[model samples]
Target chain A: MPADLTRRKLIWGGLGAAAAAYAGALGYPVYRYLADPAEEAAELAKVTEMELPEEELPAAGSATILQFGARKAILIRHDDDTMVCFSAVCTHLGCTVAYQADQDRIYCACHGGVYDPRTGQNVSGPPPRPLEEFNVERLDGKVVIRRA
Target chain B: MWRGSMAKSSSAGLSALGARVWNWCDERLALSSIWAIAEKKTVPLHRHTFWYFWGGISLLLFIVQAITGVLLLIYYRPGPEAYDSVRSITYDIQFGWFVRSLHSWAANLMVFAVFVHMFSVAFMKAYRRPREFGWWTGLALMGLVLVFGFSGYLLPWDELSYFATAVGLEIPRSLPGVGALIANIVQGGPEVSTVTVQRFFALHVFVLPLVFMGILGVHLALIMKHGSAVPPSEEARPERERRSIPFFPNFATQDLVMWLICFNVLCVMAFVFPWQLGKPADPLASAPEGIHPEWYFMSQFQVLKVLGEWIPGYLGEILGIGLFTLGGVLWGLLPLYDNTSQSGVRARHATWLALIALIGLLALTIWGYAGL
Candidate 1:
């Protein structure tokens, strides 16, 4: 009877040791994810309600970079003097492609991927699709991207 | 004579049905003793050194990762849409967070175990002689696994992933002529884009898994062919006359026990901390304060600092990258390196120490990444 109890105890002990070693191995990545930045953004994006503004248009020949809500936007004045909004995320790896005024094209420094500012087309490089476009309207002088 | 021939034909007919029809011939059939075969194949009764347990433990971790990783995939979204999907998973699914964390942790353990196993194999000069290919195979698998880690690191679409990937892409950019080209392909054009996440997600969850599985299959098959090394003992045989258990029932039972224990630990981790979803990767937002490579690559990250992007020109850089690869190939073809006999306990111990030192240095490089 004593031997049987000892054997049972041994089996459970072995089981416990194995479980602990396995958990110990997983320490680092868990620490990394807990401290990630994305969690912060999720907190920031939550809104009860936000009243967007109205403004006079910046002009037809140039573009403006906007950070509204959690999204980045490139608001361009088209040939018609109307504002068009598009997500600044490069159609490629999701890098924020910036408008280079000198070149009149959006360029991603990460991989040298370039896209057309007007059409959001992949002019040169590895973009599988064009930049995602969003509709914008001028209520007064201010511009609001239709998120809803 | 006619009656005996008829009897043999009838038995052959029974075997044709695929059931154990031969059992009916029990009366006259020549019965070879399967028990005798088992006896001949049995491992000698001997206990393994504790170090020997490391490889079994590593195998245990690998199996754990496979199970956990598969479960995590059901909730993982590997595209521009990854962040939202992961959120929904945490809130909507029962035990979603638990599963994800378990998967994440299991992957971490697997990488740790594989490295430990790898170093063990190297030190014991277990890669020597007929098993050199086995050694090389393990090494190549190690490379594939790191790639697995790097690619998967970006899948969660969190801020850390965003920054880590930005750093990760720079390694290829340091390559030379093809560096830019490779970086573009990896990024799915330019910058950290959704496709980059998608591509890495595919590689992490699908492609690398396939390749790793293939190499692993080959690795175990070769280990079986070559046999495992028995650790050095006070009552030891000369290396030349050393023998091993046939790697089946002898080691398999322990592997099972190790796996069960590892799984239980993983469960505890899942419940305690759960997998935390990071801030959604926002391109416009700058990276958080301090960013580091995933643990498995910490050593290599340290190397990059010391080595400082020394790929030379495009060709030279390619060569630099190729050197380790070349070493792997050379290591794999061990049977060819010296088919000659290496006999003695001293030689075995020396080989073991050499392999351990090499692996230890590599791990140190990772450990020192922060310093660099």
Candidate 2:
């Protein structure tokens, strides 16, 4: 090859190599990012069970707050023989729902949303879905609450 | 032995077939004439030649947005299911996050490139005489791009986008006569709802793209017809002093190299700080604290906020909207307003006015970033 042709080829080759290296440097991380899926299910699957004394459990027509994992849940003793649990977070706007003993339903203060304690169904207002229900069990002398 | 020879013969036959097909098409279409035109094109070479690359860079980013956007459309759903579908695409679908993030980032980068191209053209006075229509088309494209960003913002149906869009739609309400009507048409109802989301999705994916492509086609045709603009300084110089480099290899190679660099930067941004989907929107809930529009709209947001505080009520909104509209109109009609000849040596007063407007916008953007 001519001397000038060799010099031009060397310069172009060097620039192309540099560009390839830069692409690899940037692309490797993006490859990893696209490859890995966010593990939201695994994070939410962590279960926490808490046991409360029988006397501490709310009586019929009343409810008490309980902690499960990172969420707040309402545990209600619907009747002498029945107990139920529902997430305190409202289905409408995610505000904490308050147990209304007088109204006989759970109430969200942000909006006038109401839910049935027995079924966790949105009976009135703007809520579109029922409050998420959690598993509740009575064993021996204590009431156990498990997050769903 | 027969299988190997047959395979070799088939490959050779395919090459012959491809050549014959090319010749048949070339005979009717006269493809060589197109090649001759490309070969004859030349780009001006001067100190301000670097500015020319900005247009090409903007075009490159637009192409990137188109590709990535189509990829995203395969998985994206509009309306009530929009938020969840976006989440699923990002977290569950294979390589969906990368494609979505690339689309989002490229949209932002394209806007940035367009702004730079606009300013460079302004400072260089490339919008003179024959290029006046080209300038108008460019301004129209910029408006269309901003609309694209606004429409795309609501597609995810997240809290930030929800409130930001509410504020965005409210701006048009300050117009005197048909403000509310225009706002209603843009939003598809009295308020932002499923219908609004559907309309915005249509605008972002179908309506805006079609309009943008049409304007872009005209703008590109204008550019090619007129060739690249001569810088004001170069234009003032003697004809013998002017110089140019061939567009085929010299200018095109530089554009390609810049595009490669920009691609690397885009990949790094999409990977390192991928766009986030904020909390799902709840219409019943009040707008969240510190809610703001995208960065590109920050200046207008700050303007409205400050003016509203000072004037108190609809008056402030009208004044701010009026001022912003006036600025936009002035920018669009700049060539007509300032009739400096193409080969003039002295700078026009309009150039100073443009510089001041640019500085004012930059200051407002900074103030918005400071969250004041």
Candidate 3:
């Protein structure tokens, strides 16, 4: 009886090991295939700087969204002659936030989330964090925006 | 003495050797048990017996698709060269057009067959009690088949394919907060491009087929375990009056005949109306007039369009999507609603619901085409 029990255990254990090996053999290639190829990440990382034509920049107290390496960034020229730039994506849900000149704040129309236009800080609503800030400068009459 | 002499004869020696080999394999494999199971299996016969052929027909069409799809993949590239490769296949390669047309036709036929089979099963109350899981797995298979159609529709990369995909993405894009994000991830960017094509290719060729086969295996196993369902009407009859034929030879033979008929129809369609390819997609050009998705999606497309116009904002789009999703969920939950109550009042409600849903789909589809 002991000999028969040992034989059964050996066979079952061998079968279980084979099944796991089979699963791994099929899984590894599928994982490699489905995973992000990182090419898009590389492209996004490649663009550390974006330049917008100075003429295209919005007037004081207004803002315009700029294409910044697979994302949208807002460039605002305040009434006080101070300029600030931040990602337009809402902190709560990825909706693009727009500057509301009347309220002097950036507003996510999607969920009514509000952010401080000058400091890029979430002020109210569903937003849990501040919008990412970008470095902005005037270079050769172009509004140059760089990752900060 | 006569038996011993016969066993020593030359022909008897060959027969003995064959029997020995069969016995040797049977001792290890137990093959006869499988044969016994097949012999014992039977299919129910009734006025609705014709519907049973449809599920088998869908399987037959899927086999055709698998073969022709593999053949097309040999030359069809999925990225920027997609259009050119398809163009070459249509005009350059020998018999390529035929194979492509066959695959396309088979896909459409398979979807049609699966739908018919599902509705027939619903009306038959085949989802009762023990067979509930079979219905669920079958629904999953149908969903996979629809995705297969959606993904394959975009592979040609023509103007129609490109515009259709863009419009189709709008369904997912209209969802509230992360709608656009979901759409972006699916298309691999803000718009349908080469990356979208590659993503769809991988899905259509690899991921979908693997998942489909897995689900299909379970579905067939469930069918084998439970056997063919008798319609509620037939089940009302006396048990002694009920009749069925063995699955091994009689029903299997009937299934083969149905497959042949299906093949004949498929060939006629493929040859009579070969699939066409429009001009390659131009991303910069304004979308041409009458941009629409495939016929299967027309109902939902029209719903969104009409509803969007009526409500005139995000609210309308959300309402349309919400209603459609609710209908789908209810449809998937039919088995849960009517389990073990084939003759109850709930069964009548289920039947009426199926009828209304079917008519609604047909009407919406027709309305969509007319508006187009």
Candidate 4:
């Protein structure tokens, strides 16, 4: 029986080695969950901040284009006089999105992504994430955007 | 003796007959006895990489989704009013928050894990030739997963959910020939009304799960049939290389371990986040600007919008969407034509596809952030 076991072991030794690796591999992600967020934050520390001036935004039913942080967000005055701000990146392929004044949506030229100007909801195209929101608030007569 | 026993059993009548019928199935059919599949079979003992377990984790999450969903079902209704019932499961049902969190986070992670698995498979090129069905099934599962996300989003009945779901219904409207029909059926009208919520709720909890389960069965079967993605030999066989683990005690045991770990992680999440119920979807109030679908759909969502605008409005929307859906199908089926029988690169296709997908994802993420 011992000899037979040895023979069997020889045949399946490679398989066993691989299985051990599989078990080890499973351990790695668990490790990452332990390590990831902190590591990611450190990297994020390198990112710079940007701001937008409010007067640049057009009146009600008007739109303005501005770049903030490492990306772009569009500022618009809706019919209600309240200011709405959205990122200018298309959700589909990450193309630089443009504001479509006529259609009231953000447009991506690369793949035809269209986002609602009012809500930044994807109107059309393949962008997945909604246009990101910028932290902007009214101060006096000006709307200010915080950095990434 | 057999005849005598059979006659005696029959004399005992159908109550005894039912027990007899049940006993006839035997010890091997018992779930506890399934370990027999591994008893004498060879189970490779090599290790696996961390990434490989994402699929297993994803499956675990699905199981959580199933369990929590069923538990929630005790309280959940199917109509617009049904949403409150779902909400009550969290607020009313004992430990409902745990269950709801399990369901929500698990569903989200399942999608994430599917992406990871799919990309990993692509990086490994597991879709080659005989394994093409696996790839196709996986692709279909991906679509269904998005549907899961889409439908589940509406179940929350939040304003973001309402508008996001509305956007979800609209994406399909550009599907060329069947655009309007598909849109109407899914949306239940030209707009997202009570009917739309009802439809999304039904699909989230019922219809899509049935479809997803079927495809998942096919996907797992294919994985077992073809074996895990093989690693390149130049690196002295990846520490995680093992093709033939008995699906029982060996691989199955490992799978159980993985699930336990994932559950632990989910436990932390449920305790931490506990399935946030944002303000009940406000139809009257407009969504705050910069509303986005969850991360998973961002790439295609971004891509489709771009394509629609570039082409003539009417024509572009149709072709853009039609092409996008077809493109996904084509991507899944690509391995059918990629002959690797003699290709020495050996299982590199999956890894390559994973890389390409990552690139596309990265590019889109940048754009998504840019709101390009």
Candidate 5:
């Protein structure tokens, strides 16, 4: 009986060890495959500053969305000629928020998220957080937006 | 006399050779035992016997889908060429439109049939005792079927499919923490680009089929092990009064006849109303009006939409998903909770739960369409 018990225990131990090894062997490859290579490169490309020419800026009282290091940023020039830049992605579900010139606010059509264009604050609807604001600089013939 | 004797001897010799070959295989494989098991298997005949046919109907449609899908794959290409390839199939290739239409129609019909089969099983209280695994496996299969439909929907790369898939991905993207990561992996990036098409194509054609086939094998094996569950009503009858037909030639024959009818219906739908290919998707273009998902997904879509409007600060969408998940868990675990009160009687609370769920699904689906 003692010998039989030892044999069974050895068998079970071997099986458990084999199972763990097998899981690690399979899981690592899957993890690597699901980790997007492009995402890593995008991370590496993130810089503190992006320069846009004044000619490239949209007409005053309107807005334009641009790519900033794998993320979307919106640039708006109010009627009074003050320039503001904020992340275009809604805090609610990552849907792109659009500047509504008529309402003088940013609106996310996905879930009706509303934000204050001037301050980039969550005003109403399902947005849980305020949009990330960026500092805008006016140089000679250049409009530079710097990440905050 | 000589010619007659020679012909008779030759025929006898052929029979003896055939019998020897059969015996050789039987000794190694025990084929006769399998035949015996089939001969002994039986299906109970009752008023609810008709409900039993829906499972077979779904299986038949799945088979049709497999064949038509393979036919489409012969000409279909994924990625940037996806839209063009499908366009060529629909407009240029011989009988390609029919194959695509059949696959689409079969997918829809199979989903409907599975739903009916599941509800019938629930109402009939077929998910009791030893057959609990059958119910669970069936639910898993249904979930796989939905995934199959969703993934396949995006393969065509048309305007409707692209935008609908984009909207559908919102459900997962709305999730907290790993939501962005999951969405990135699923869509192959931050957006539903050509890469998304390739990923979905792989999922639809290869990954999903492999998993689906494995689960389906288990489900069928379980059905064979337990036979068909006689409804509670049928079970209440005296054993002497109960009637059952052998599965081999009897129940199988009925199943085949139902499949034939289903095939005819599929053919008519595929031929009469061919599936349409819309304009190619433009990522920058605004979503067209009345954009909604497939009918199977309409309920959840409507729930999210209504709740998103009513609640504030992401709480409403969260609540909507939470409630839906809770309901699904309860439904999937029905066999575990509703196992008691056996002996050929319907469980009252379980029935009521199922009825409410059914009514809610129907109402929500209708509301989704109406609002659209």
Candidate 6:
């Protein structure tokens, strides 16, 4: 090949090779970065259970907040010895709901959203859906809250 | 004789198959003509040729933003969960931190690249005559990109973004007639709430991207139609003295090299200085001290602050907003104001004006950072 043609080939070839190498180096991490997080699958199978002594439970008609991993749950005890728990995050906007003993409903201060404590149903507010209910079991003198 | 005949028959069969494929494609599309045009394309080489890469850099950053933004969307939840979800993505999700950081860093760099591209084009006076529409589209893209930055800033739902957005939304209220209306639309109500966040999220993810893609298509088409503008100085030279290079392999290779360098820089920045979440937003709390908008908005923010101090009340805000709007209008109509034919003494006034504006912005940015 002529000198000029050979020089052009070398320059173009080098650029092409360098570009490919750079892309490969950067693209691998980018592909991994864009992939679905492994935690999503792990979370699908995650089940968390926390037990509190029966004495720690709030009195009848009252409720207390429980920490579950990075989430919060409100535990309400009834006069009939039945206990109920619901995720504290309001369905409308995810604000932490507080149990109002006098009104006997869970209330979100952010937007006047209300949910029935017993059923976790949207009572009368901007909330579009009921608060999420958690499984509660009373065993061995303790209340166990199971979250999936 | 039989073996030779069989070989000839198979070769003819292969040729027939290729012809059929070509005919099938040709029936639906005219790829040959497109290729011919592409082969004929050339980019002028001159002293200011390096500046041309900024447009490509901006486009690359935008692609990065789009990809990373989509990745972030998978884990991001709007509304009150936004803050925690962002935190979870940063801390819990695997490689989420890297993706989120890359997205944020690329967004900032994209804005920077766009500004540089705009300024470079302005100085080159490339917006003359037939390129006026191109200039308008470019200006529109700049506005869209700023909107992109503003909307994306609020997605993290962190303290800085939250307060900054609140202030940003307030600026529209300074418009004379429909000011409050615009602000209301942006906020989705009288106050910034879940609705505001949702509205911003929609604008950032769906609405803006579609609009940007449309405008970008037009912009690229216009660039190809008119080819790259030769700097006025180069245009002034005799035809024999002006040199050119083919777009393929030559200019394209150089563009690829610059892109690689930019990619490396982005990676280093994303990894070295991962974007911080700041503090989670507290709606009930007052705006914190030293709270300001993103760096791109710093100059305007500083102007508002100084104006507020000097003039007092809504008057100052109105004046500041009015001035900013006027500047934007003038910038969008730059081609109309500058009718110069080429660069040199003739272009000095426009060039000096651009320089002064740049210096003024830099000074304001520094002053804003100094909290004065």
Say which candidate scores most in TM-score.
6
For model 2, residues A54-136, the per-residue Cα lDDT tens digits are 87878777788876666788987765658889999999989999988777788999999999978999999999999998889
**Candidate 1 residue spans exceeding 4 A from truth:** A1-148, B1-48, B231-250, B309-372
Q: Report the number of clashing residue pairs per model.
A: 23, 0, 0, 76, 0, 0
Better of 5 and 6 by lDDT: 5
Give one digit per residue, the lDDT tens place, for model 6 in A1-148: 6656787799999988987997787677667655555545456436488899978999987889987655788998877768899999999888999998887778999999999889999999999999888899989888889874
Best by DockQ: 6
> Candidate 4: what is its chain A TM-score?
0.58
* lDDT score for residue A64 of model 2: 84
Residues B190-236, model 6: lDDT tens digits: 87776778889999999999999999999999999999888778888
lDDT of 1 by residue, B233-254 (tens): 5226655564556435765675
Give the runs in model 6 whose Cα sits over 4 Å from its true position: A1-27, A30-148, B1-27, B340-346
DockQ, Cα level, model 2: 0.06
Q: Tens digit of lDDT per residue, candidate 5, span B39-59?
A: 999999887789999989989
Return the TM-score for candidate 6, rounded to 2 decimals.
0.74
State the iRMSD of every prediction, in order shown.
Answer: 7.3, 4.0, 13.4, 12.3, 16.1, 1.9
Over 4 Å off, model 5? A1-148, B1-6, B9-17, B341-346
lDDT tens digits by residue: candidate 4, B130-238? 7788878888888888778778878767677888887877767766679779899878888787788787777787799999999999998877656565533313554
- Shift of residue A71 alpha carbon in model 4, Å: 63
Give one digit per residue, the lDDT tens place, for model 5 in A1-148.
5656787798998988976986675355334433434545567557779999989999999999988877899999999999999999999989999999999899999999999999999999999999999999999999999997
Question: What is candidate 3's TM-score for chain B alone?
Answer: 0.95
Model 6 Cα shift for residue B358 (angstroms): 1.6
For model 3, residues B1-372, the per-residue Cα lDDT tens digits are 657766679688768778999999988999889889999999987778999998999999888888889878877999999999999877766566777898899999998899899999988889988998999999999999999999999999999989889988988998888999999999999999989999999999999999999999999999999999998888889999998988989999999879878887897898899999999998987899988888888999999999989999889988999998899899989988988744898899899989988899999999999999
- Please give me the total number of clashing residue pairs in predicted model 1: 23
